[model samples]
Target: MKAETDFDKAEKLYNQKKYSEAKVLFESFLKENPNNYKSIEYLGDIAGHQKDWNEAIKEYKILKNQFPKTANYWYKYGGALGMKAKSVNKFKALGMIDEIESSFLMASKLDLKHIDSRWALVMLYIELPGIVGGSESKAIKYSNELMNLSKVDGYLSKGFIDEYFKRFTKAEMNYKAAHEIGNSKITFQKLYNLYLNKIKDKFKAQKLKEQFEK
Candidate 1:
């Protein structure tokens, strides 16, 4: 009961964004309750939020080993690895790509309805260069998969890819479609940026921005 009480306090601190304080409490709690999955998960999340990717990776790796079948654990592990790759040399980043991809893939396979894993794959495929495992086809494939699961996310992913390629018209179209489907603030923001930056239509951009603000 005392351990649970302490953990709840630590979690409240984490929720309040007192990450450093929360980390100390969580660490102490884990020392007493080594197999507490929730504490371990929060420790990993705290490390990631603090941009301590190595520590995040280490914590998530423990979670992955402890909960091999849990999709969320693998997804988080992949996400941490992806963030770590962004901060490293190109060669090192390249080496991490396979592990990152494998983790996301495992998560997706474990839970077909895991939208976060699919979204991560879409971004990964779009951001990496072809020489190092990125593929436009793979991006489109995941986008299609997301579409099958959630029309709004699918269109948003497609818009993101088109925007990346500077295909402003296609991006605008997809963003509009996503907006029609979900009216999400994110879709409006993307449309606002597209009109302001790529289409150079301040009027449309202002309207989109206003919609986003609402």
Candidate 2:
């Protein structure tokens, strides 16, 4: 009962974003209840939020090993790995690519409706060099899958790809389609960014801001 209470308190701290406090309690709880998956997940999240990627990866790796069927664990592991790769030298980053791809792939396969994993894959395919296995077609394939799952995600992802390739006009059109269908902050932000950043159409951006405000 005491252990459960301690865990509950720790969880509340984490929810409140008192990460340093929660981390201490979680670490102590972990020593006493080594197999508590939720506690381990919280520690991993705190580590990620703090940019302690190695610790995050270590914690998530433990969870994925213990719960191989849990799609979110794999996704968390992959996300940590991707972030770590970005902070390293290009050679090191390249070496980590396969693991990152495989982890996200497993998550996507396990949960067909996982929008984030598909988005990760779309970005990965678009960003990877051709020699290392980048493919616009593969990115498009995942974008199409997202379309079937959620129109907003589908169009946003497609717009992201177009923007990456500097196809500003196509990106604008896709973002517009997404905003038209979704009409949410996420869609609005994408369109506003394209207008203000890539296309540099200040008038359109102001117009979008006014409309969104109303």
Candidate 3:
């Protein structure tokens, strides 16, 4: 009970944006409950938010191993692996990407509601170098599927809907939906403009016209 209380306090601190203090408390909590999956998950989250992808991968992997049946654990493990892959060499990144896809696929199989896995897979396909794993067509297909699915409520759906799929006209439409939903103006603007930027291909006239036509 005390441990749970401490964990709650640390979580509250994290929510309040007191990262350093939250880290300290979470660390203290983990000293007594080293295998607590939730604590491990939160540690991974804090590390990710700090851009400490290696640490995030470690903690999330531990949680995934400890809780194999939990789709959330695998999804987070894949997400951390994806982030960590960015800093590794190409061969190593490909290996990590494989791990990421495998883990996310497992998560998706366990729970179709695991939208984060879907988004992560699409992101990996889109962002990877062509020689590594990139495929624009695959990215577009996954993104479209995710967009359609995002209309229903669940983890990552709202952000994926507004940020990933909302291209040009769709984005303009979502901007209105975001506002109606009382989403932060700054967040909505970032999503709206970011999508426009992506579809525009550096505002290349031919590319913009082509995508606009699509």
Candidate 4:
């Protein structure tokens, strides 16, 4: 009961964004209950919020090993690895790419409906060089998979890929499709950027900007 009360207090502190204070409590709780998954997960989240990617990776890796069936554990592990790779030297980043991809893949396999894992995989495939496992085809494949799961996300992902490749017209079409499906802030921002920067249409860009501002 004392441990539970302490954990609840730590969670409240975390939710209040008092990360340092929460970290101390969480660490104390974990010392008493080393196998408490929630405490480990929160510790990983706290490290992520602090941008201590290496520490986050360590915590998430432990979670993944201890709870191999939990999709979220693998997803968090992959995400931390991806962030750590981005923060490191180029040579080191190159070596970490495969591990990151594998972790994301494992997460996706563990839960077919895991949208975040699929989205991360799509971005990884799109961003990496061909020599290092980047494949536009794979990106498109994942985008299609997202389309099957969530229409809005699918269109947005496809639009992002198109814009990345400078296929402005196709990007506009996909972005418009996404906007029609759901006029979300992200959709509006993408359209605004497309009109303002890519198409150089100030009128359309201003309209979208105003809509988004509201």
Candidate 5:
């Protein structure tokens, strides 16, 4: 039997979100055909999306080496670094600020059309520490950018948004947003009720009750 085509295998793995496996296939294909920038870029994206930050960083690093004139590679690399720092090593988090911002800045400068890169930069800006990379204004700015990118009213995203903004009242307005969307497979109602009962304040309880009714 003939081996599966590189594209076919990669596509299947990608659809499954099997970044590590997909990346291996992509890398093998790239080794045979180094000019496939799109494949390389997608590999980096998949790695990042899968939260395999180191793999993402490695993929982007390869792209940056191949396409030194473009900033997208660097931007992706920095974003991966930022995620790695944030989710894994708090001590290394601040150190990545310069790398993250620089990549975003370069990507913006190189291609004003790369909304995703810019949006990534914005998110990093929002998540960074105040002494390091945190800025409330920047957070709001990037949050808006992310919302615009998402055409659908994403239930999980909206819930996090409400939680972040302290708009718990509004969260109840769409608590069903997640529940219905997930077909009740994801139970926020149970989690919310748990929190509601844990609170000691009467006014807070009343507020929760009113919000739950909505």
Candidate 6:
């Protein structure tokens, strides 16, 4: 009961973005309930929020090992590793790419309906060089898969890829579809960004902002 109460307090703090206070409570609770996976997951999230990617990686590794069947665990583990790779030298980043890809692939394979892992794979393939398995077609394949899972995500992802490749017109069409379908902040932002940053269309950007804000 005490452990549960402590965990609840920590989780509340964590949700409120009070990482330091939550971390203290979680650590204290962990001392009593060392095997608490939820507590460990919170610690990992806190570490990630603090940009302590190594700590995040360590915690997520434990999570993946403990819950091999959990796609979320593998996703978190892969995400942490990918963040670490971004901070390191190119050679080292190259070395870690396969492991990161494998983890995300495992997560995707484990959960076919998982959107996040597919998005990660899309970005991974799009960003990587051809030598390392980057392929525009592969990215499109995942984007299509995302389209099946969630139309908004699918359109948003397709817009992202089009923007990445400088297909501004295609991106605009897709972003518009996403906003029309979802009408959420993310969709709005994507459309706004394309007009403002990518296409440099102040008229469209202003019109979009006005429409979205209303």
Best by TM-score: 6
Error of 1 at 109 (Å): 0.8
lDDT (Cα atoms) of all candidates against the true structure: 0.93, 0.95, 0.69, 0.92, 0.66, 0.95
lDDT of 6 at 129: 92
For residues 25-76, write the lDDT of model 5, one tens digit per residue: 8888988988888787888798778788898898888888888768768777
TM-score of 6: 0.97
Q: Total clashing residue pairs per candidate?
A: 0, 0, 0, 0, 2, 0
Worst 10 residues of 2 by lDDT: 1-10
Q: What's the CA RMSD for each of the models? A: 1.6, 1.5, 7.2, 1.8, 6.4, 1.4
**Higher TM-score: candidate 1 or 4?**
1
Per-residue lDDT tens digits for candidate 6, residues 14-37, read 999999999999999999999999
Candidate 5: residue 190 lDDT (0-100): 31
| Model 2: residues with Cα > 4 Å off, grouped in runs | 1-4
Q: Could you tell me the lDDT of residue 49 within candidate 6?
A: 98
Scanning candidate 6 in windows of ten residues, the lowest lDDT window is 1-10
Residue-level lDDT of model 2, residues 6-40, one tens digit each, is: 78889999999999999999989888998888999
Reference-based lDDT, residue 4, model 5:
88
Candidate number with the higher lDDT (2 or 5): 2
Model 1: per-residue Cα lDDT over 1-214, one tens digit each? 4456679889999999999999999999999999898999999999999999999999999999998999999999999999999999988998999999999999999999999999999999999999888999999998999999999999999999999999999999999999888877777777887899899999998877776677
- State the lDDT of candidate 3 residue by residue for 128-180, as single tens digits: 77786677666666556665666422222334344544445554455445444
Question: How do all the candidates rank in terms of TM-score, highest first?
Answer: 6, 2, 1, 4, 3, 5
Q: Against the hidden reference, what TM-scores do the models get?
A: 0.95, 0.96, 0.69, 0.94, 0.58, 0.97
Off by over 4 Å in 5: 1-4, 18-21, 68-72, 141-214
